[model samples]
Target: MEKAKAFLDKLTEEEHERVSRLPFKNDFKFYEDFALLGMHVDLVKPGLVSCSFKVPPRLTDGNGNLASGAIANLVDEVGAAVIYVEGLPMNVSVDMSMSYLSTAKLHDELEITSRLLGRKGGYSGTLVLIKNKTTGEVIAEGRHSLFGKPASKM
Candidate 1:
């Protein structure tokens, strides 16, 4: 519509840059890698995944604490990784429940653990917990639900 087009035309140069839209043709890069930057996998096994990371300023909320959005992305990514099956497409998030218990400041080491609660057909449930490595204080907890299509017989 003309009205919508006019509204889009009114976007400022800075606004356009901040929008983060990218061409989807080829050689695309993920925009959210900063959320998982410096993460180190400490352990992995059936039904469980554990990792550690140090909070970086790029992931902060400008108040010296990790941003809530970054925490949610971690829950989604790590949570899905816990239940991943070989030769199948990646699981897609169905729902997420998050509880932010405390804040994590820059350079604070974080311990993240994800456990598979269960799986039925293509639906899976996972629990992700993030804690401060030094104090062992809970930073956030997430219950994530995901669905992945079963691999077909060739």
Candidate 2:
């Protein structure tokens, strides 16, 4: 974590400001939920990232269950957050495939970890896994592909 923080600290002021202005970081709802759930940026690299999200009641769906969409959103956010923190311009999700391996109830804290798998030109890919914090069970997994040039290219 300290290493990641040090990496982030090296960003120029202009770079940091550009990243902070990303839609995911600036969205009030996303920011509020990330803060409320105790989500933290743990590690980040060019195409890899890991973060954790604490499940709270407010994140549950209508069936009193943790919605798969919510899980997907968490995965996407953490994966994208990694790129943003690295001072890269925001990329758009071109495709996202998800599978719900298990169900989670309210208050079930989750750790969402993602890694950049590969990239070709302006296209990049990532893999994400959502695991149960207590039981260490994998509740969900996903793969996302993003399309966009690097921020510096813009």
Candidate 3:
């Protein structure tokens, strides 16, 4: 366990230095821009969407597996895309529930798919699944709920 401790100590120091130099500004990046940086949209329909992404080193955790936060970000982005319309304001995430079934390693190709569950007025729900493309292993699943501006009745 000494090796693990040494590794952790080094990574912690690096992260500490990185965070200490941070200055808050409007230049902050959104989750979509960061986590979906390398994502490629494959297919899209009114209530369904599919994407292809290779697990990048920048999105991996200490164990070399895809970071859980990255998976969650993907869920939010892809889930919203399934229902997004041109010229419409983006929906805001209300709640998200996720189940991490497996881990994805660096350079592993992933297939992400999202499907609409149902909608009510201004609220919508969707389900997203992330899986390793080669091994067909399921990586994660998320249920996302979002709220948008209500449509006009006229």
Best by TM-score: 1
What's the residue-level lDDT of 38 in candidate 3?
A: 73
lDDT digits (tens) for residues 1-154 of candidate 1: 9998888788899887765564232443455454565899999999999999999888899799999998998899899999988888898999999999999999999999999999888899999999999999999999999999965656
- Per-model C-alpha lDDT, please? 0.90, 0.75, 0.89
Instruction: Give the per-residue Cα lDDT of candidate 3 at 106.
Output: 93
Model 3 Cα shift for residue 120 (angstroms): 0.7
Model 2 clashes, total count: 0
Return the lDDT, model 2, position 87: 50
Error of 2 at 88 (Å): 4.3
Candidate 3 residue 69 Cα shift, in angstroms, is 0.8
Predicted candidate 3 versus true structure: per-residue lDDT over 66-95, tens digit per residue: 999989989998999997866778899999
Better candidate by lDDT, 1 or 2: 1
Please, what is the TM-score per model? 0.79, 0.69, 0.78
Q: Which stretches of candidate 1 lie over 4 Å from their true place?
A: 1-28, 151-154
Q: Pick the candidate with the highest lDDT.
A: 1
